[model samples]
Target: MQTGYADHLNLLCDMGELISVLRDSDDIHMFLDQTVALVARHLKAQVCSIYLYDESAERLVLRATMGLRAEAVGVVSMAAGEGLVGRVFDSLQPLCTGECRIHPDYLYFSEAGEDQLLSFLAVPIHRGAVRIGVLVVQHEQADSFGDMDVRALRATASQLGSALENARLLLSLGGGAEGSAGLFQARTPSLSLVRGKAASPGCAMGPALILGMHRCDILRDEAEPERSGGMACFHAALDKTLAELNALQERFARRLPESASLIFTAHFMMLKDPSFRRRIEEKINLGLSPMAAVRAAAGHYIAIFASSSHAYIREKVSDIEDLACRLLRNLKPGEGKDAEGVKNGGIALAGELFPSDVLKLVSEDVTGIVLVSGGLTSHVAILCRSLQIPLVIVEESGVLRIPEGTPLLVDGAAGNLYVRPDDSIREPFVRTQAAWSAAESFTGTMSESTWSRDGGRVRLFANINLLSEVPLAIRSRAEGIGLYRSEFPFLIRSAFPTETEQYQVYRRLFAAMPDRVVTIRTLDAGGEKVLSHVDSAGESNPELGLRSIRFSLLHRDVFEAQIRAILRAAEGSVCPRIMFPMISSLDEFREARSIVYDCMTALEKEGISYHSAPQIGMMVELPAALELIEDFAEEADFFSIGTNDLVQYMLAVDRSNPRVAHYYQPWHPSVLRALARIGKAGRAAGVDVSVCGEMAHEPALIPFLLGVGIRTLSLDPQFMPAVQQQIQTMDLREAEEHARELLGMSSIASVASYIGVEKRA
Candidate 1:
């Protein structure tokens, strides 16, 4: 609002006009060089520099400069919050100082020749929540910069945000293929090993199928008049993409588990989102063609998603790009053929893969995937795991440039990739592969009951996540369903499912396994598995905060609705058991049970047919419940040992945190003691006890569990045969003797050493 500020604003606008006239063919480095020179001239400053944030390194890299030494352009860099530029970026505010040497956060670099520089002004450059970089100006004289200077620099940076983002995206996508020589760096595969994160656990050996090599040239921002039929063309493509997604979702639901099928639901939601459509429409209204409009809109979303610190949010970038690519393919057929050359029984090598792309690979029977972008917990990685496909995330982008048909062996369990391996590597993996294939055939029939050599029977149940997995459980010969995670349905949806919707899902679950016990856990929606629709946010430590049974009690209406759905869905079912998770106290268990009774009563008053006496149980997963097992057993009908949470809570380690994941040992002495104590208490009180966590399916721990009197074991359906085979190999007497010796040990190392197979030698 000052006269000088108004004049400076006009100057910034003039700089924007100059930037707008620049063409797509202009080099990004040239543009940055010109912009900095113009800013220095306009502001009458000694130096002006542009520092961009490199997300992978978490550093502010100096990209261009006007007055500093030319060599320092790419060499000078600092970590976020390491210097004055970082302080401005961290605070997202303009910073000006008259005496740069006296400032506490000032960082000096000799290569920049800024020792004599006294006046400094910096402003954070960002678009919405995305932090792009920082723009700074310097002067030789003290107090040379003023308020007008800061305001002008800030305005100029704002105008540069969009152009910089577009340029960056174009450069990254376009620089890969200079010609055939650069694209095909290696004609013959070299012997080498690359390491990455293990996404899904398995081994795969096959020829590599290179993908994502096509650089669609639709991202250029050139002047083009809007076509007359652009809206119609856009709508036709939109409908086709939606249809393709629907078919994909249906195919996955029919063939894969519900979790894998729901990966496409986000695609469907985005296509139907009003805001996404509005963005494209706005671009079209601005005289751009339909294809260009979609690209511009998608590029905006991709930039925002790629800038996020949260891994989950950042994963959305692929989904957005996939949608745009699909739309462009529909808009103009035959172009952007990135996946055209893929074949069956091959390994997919790419920079990154979308969720739909993963499903397509599964359909084509691709053996494994080697990605340069995805994390272990990403949606595509989860889909690969659910589909039993091997996936490894490597940092080696050169794999994309490797010749087609290169023999690549992926060790998903070890996170290693062997390129054109010799017999030394091939022979062992071949034997392992043959042995795995033979074992996976699962010669044992599912109808036969499993028993130890000492004649103690052990029941095997399936831990179901969705209704689609019920058939898998039945085919695997699981006697019943245990630990049905009730939170997954809530997690996938944008809003809480209504009672009718919940009842329908539950009905399908019970109808699939008639006359068999199905232990459905109540809403365990907190901690790491927070519901998007619920107001359970801002907890510093969510694992110890309102979660599990505590969360169910706090939101009693949600608990009762879920209870009512379960009760109503179990009208004709013989054995439907309701279980509560994370019960830390006696009062929590009592309150949850009281709510179950209230739901039953309310259903009866409404003249609805419902089960009156579904069995109630509690998961003994906390140390408090482990120590006071007798008290909980006295009040509860049965106990399910949720070993995943029990081990995490008892050891005070976040199993999901990679830094402390090693400390989450289920084989620890105290964890074993707690399991043994719970089994003893349950037997004393005549309460049926079951192990329904990951510990149940572990082949090494099955004997120990039976020794501790845990007769019922629940696990993933895929592991049922292996656990059954392990049970058949063990004698209950030997297991009991081993359990006695193991529980007597005080140290974890002693327990591990005593049970280790090498110790027997």
Candidate 2:
């Protein structure tokens, strides 16, 4: 074999092994140390080091190293933009240089022992759009690192970022390390304060009602002590769990949005996985008791998912744990009881919570929720937001020692939980609540139409994802429904909802707001939000791949069912507008419209009463859509700019990823330009344009949006009053001038400064 071919094959084998170790390991320190050693050996580099970004300190701290001083692991730190490593993080771009010492940005860290190294290659380790750290490999010889070396480092760096995040979460929850008795351990303090991600924005003070952790004690009896009876018991337990989950799903489906109820469906699917059941059966056949077998099987899968490098997969660990506990409780009847003595207006505290548990608390009149280990995007968080409940998530270690029934103050908006507070501190909270109530009453009396000081008016619409939110929209005095996310019904169900079911939902929405215009957006699923019944296979990049309109068009059966339902519901009442999501091209829009026409024709042939033709629109979320706005405007009735996706795709940032969230700026000069272009094209084509994403509700951005000629703004119902109040105080002429200056600005800092200065004036 040729030497080059032999070397390439060796590289591939090394990478495979490296990735295997990275994926299998759950310890962050171990993973980083192993990574540096592997890279240094495979690439023939003199040194390899990983530096993780410390947000609190705003510096890059050396976390692991190979062929360098071992003592510098946690001590050496560099400010962002301070050295070669900092430059990589600041630029969020790779840097390679044959002459490392001569670089202007180079900073000497004697402990690193890189004095003899010449060639250097550094790549930023990013989790989605967020830059978490930097990976650097140095060689003793100049020009030693090539493109292949850079590529390999980048792949490894990506894996490292994901693994690091998973490990951090595990450590925070006290799940990965040994000798940790509980999820958290709080240090003694005068008044313990636990900080967490703000899931739902609100403030509430109440006594702490700690929910007990339920675990089924496993007996060490011989495996299959009762032989065939053991297998029977396991199967029966599984069946009962599945039935319970189904019942829970049905109950939640009635009250919450279908999306919230989908959590149960996921748990139900897990119980049905053949492999998961087989694992337990194999253990049971080995003479293990059914309960023991179930515990072992669940532990195995939980470890695997918890060690995963992907954030989405890592999150499933919580679900698996929840399932295991439920199954165990089912297997051992009378072993665990549901949370009792939940006081009205109490803040429920738990190490972890499932969607069902959160729903129960809500029903018990629990004022707020505080979790030790739950993601901001979890189903429980979604339910809390929908129910308008305050939710704060603190690290387990921070609040593990707080006593039950202790008076506590939870500020979800600020992401803080006070263990106990004195009257001086608590008094401010009471005053704030009173002031908020006054503001709410005042805004509640305002008219639906919002006008500026300069006599310019903009219609305020509500963006709702669930049919249950219709009344809230009406209460907010919204002029209309700007964007009704039409995917929740499909998302939460075990299978596709029948046309009749879809029609009933749409009819209820129309009935709730008979006088207002309702714009229903078609199913936007298949990316982060996946459907169980749909085939989401073979799409390597779901975000930019078969999602949104692409998924709907490919699955014409589902699309037609939805379209037929919407058409039929609008037959006798005011015709609601239909908007297609993620329309990137004129051809895609036309094809979707064609499908709608076909659905109408089919309904006509069946002699079903339906609105044959209704107002059609497209969401301008993609840069491609912005580029072809003129063509789309000519064919569509109106355009709604989905700024969330528009900014994400345009900036090449994933908004959900914490590392790159800062880059997903709505006020970027380019984003502003795109909005302006869409507004201009809509005006030219005599089409109404609306801003419907979260950006529309931002008070700072509201002035700019209005100034850009977008006369229609849709936002969350909770934000409408605040936005209206801000609008009533703004002058359109001043806003237009501010927007013009903002359009010329290049940085988010500049935009923020302009808004801040204007607000102060």
Candidate 3:
């Protein structure tokens, strides 16, 4: 921001070219030497060094020094909280001393005989939250690192964070750092650097931690007169690296202990298989190092594989494709963003942030971001989704084709990113904008007793995980929470949350809606919500396997913790509705209700004031559950039709598997017949019935659901108003006639088409 500060940054950037070849180091000392020299040259410092956090020893070891003694390299180690470097490591914060001697927090570790120390700056190189180490810049002339120097160093430190995070994960994925812990950590946004379109509109800018230049010896064979002349030595080096990669892949495959994530295995299998390796060999025959050749070939083929293969391929190929892409990015030219621009007030746009770009995504001031290269469940995408940031992935054609910093639009709901739209293109979006505005306006006209106009009162409840969604729910004016998927906290947490931790989350969530009912589903452990740390049971088919009620039935302690917290969170005032998933029989309900009673008994024993009676419900998903619904109807308070699973099960289709996914029709007369049967069965016994499948938003299914005596619908909050409008327009007689006529139809498609006829018409 200052004239002098600008000069300092420019000087540092200018010095990047000098160390272009220093990246060939395999030794830590070499890396430290190159790093210090680069810093000293860039800052015009008389003294410069790097202090690394030796986590095992709990100290900062002076790795490389410019003006300090030679003996300080490995001998000088201090506690993480002991000295200047230690303080930075402990705090994970940068400190600048304009006058080193007068600085109160400054603690000197080395006995520099006669070196004058005037100014100083040190910053932590963090992958995400953990401070891996610190980078130090010093000068004999005092006050070298001013406010400007501090800012630049901090920015540089971020670059280090980004690079290391990317390098570790990518290398780990590529089969290099095989046994390292490559856990999923959410990217926190830097308050100082805002990402906008720099040279690209569609591309999202993550942390730009460019290592400036390659540090390792990536050999490039000179164009030889004959390919066979130096072939033996070349092949020997290639074989060794390939061996290294295989070992890496094996380690990775072993690290993935979760059941049935075949993609990870496929990645390792590919590395070991000859077909993929032969492609690299072919590239090497044309003179590339086997390492670079394998990476390049892998990128090309894997991209093709991901693009052409089955939906299962996408998930399975994630580890492989992600590894390939990261290696490609690192091998390519440039770092951070190629061009510069601003948006919502911050630096935006960076070169392709492949899945490996682990940027810090801080909570405040985060609005929108676009990733040119990622999928819906890529580590980055999943993390951002958990953080409630709008992100779009899987648009490779747009990444290269779109211009930099062009006005872009993203619809995270639909997984769509509109790049540089023509003026007329924006006109259609205005209608969507109007719909959003109208939805917002309903915040005042709504409360918990809300229902659709057709006298078919459907609860427009939100499915929430993170607290971030609370604001969106309030803004959307959701009547209550339908499915508070409890797995997200477990998904994001480092370990199984203590009761107190779970209670805190529950308390905050309940406090957010003091009057509204919140239905918190007990932790759905298996299938999609896998907890890596927990010792979950493996199943032949996880979706149908030991998941949901099955998981709860066996793992009682885990189940009890969630149930108790849900009741405790309900406290005295806000009515709480608790539900279980995959309930197959009345016995499971009896067992589940026992757990509920046990939870209540515990609370009563603790003498905490709470609801004596919380409404208990079960997801009527499995066929056995539907068949026995009549038996459990008297025991259960309400039945929220889990149509997502019901349609899949009844149709003999798997919703997640894309192949037969087309057969998953909610309109299928069979599905409607099942719904009518269940809804009517629940209604006859005086049990309230609600439908919560994706079909609740389907205009045609509404009439069928209403016709089935389904009194309540719990659709998404955004769809509630529109659904309500539809319900208010139709009478019970009309819906009954429509359902009776449609039920007689042969196909769900026809029923849907029949429902397509406007009720007003």
Reference-based lDDT, each prediction: 0.77, 0.75, 0.59
RMSD of 3: 25.1
Q: What is the lDDT of candidate 3?
A: 0.59
Off by over 4 Å in 2: 1-191, 212-254, 257-345, 423-432, 453-455, 490-501, 526-542, 655-664, 729-753, 757-761
State the weakest 10-residue window (summed lDDT) of model 1: 180-189
- How does model 1 score by TM-score? 0.69
| Candidate with best lDDT | 1
In order of lDDT, best first, we have 1, 2, 3
Instruction: Estimate, for each residue in 192-232, the C-alpha lDDT of model 2 and write its tens digit.
Output: 46666788878888888867322111321224233245888
Worst 10 residues of 3 by lDDT: 184-193
How far is 527's C-alpha from truth in model 1 (Å)? 4.8
lDDT of 3 by residue, 370-452 (tens): 54333343445555555445665322211322343445555555555555545565666667667767876775565545544
Identify the runs in model 3 with alpha carbons over 4 angstroms from their true place.
Answer: 1-367, 372-375, 386-388, 395-404, 411-419, 446-462, 470-479, 535-540, 757-761
TM-score leader: 1
- Model 3: lDDT of residue 211: 21
Judge candidate 3 at residue 545 and give its lDDT.
Answer: 68
Clashing residue pairs in all predictions, respectively, total 0, 10, 27
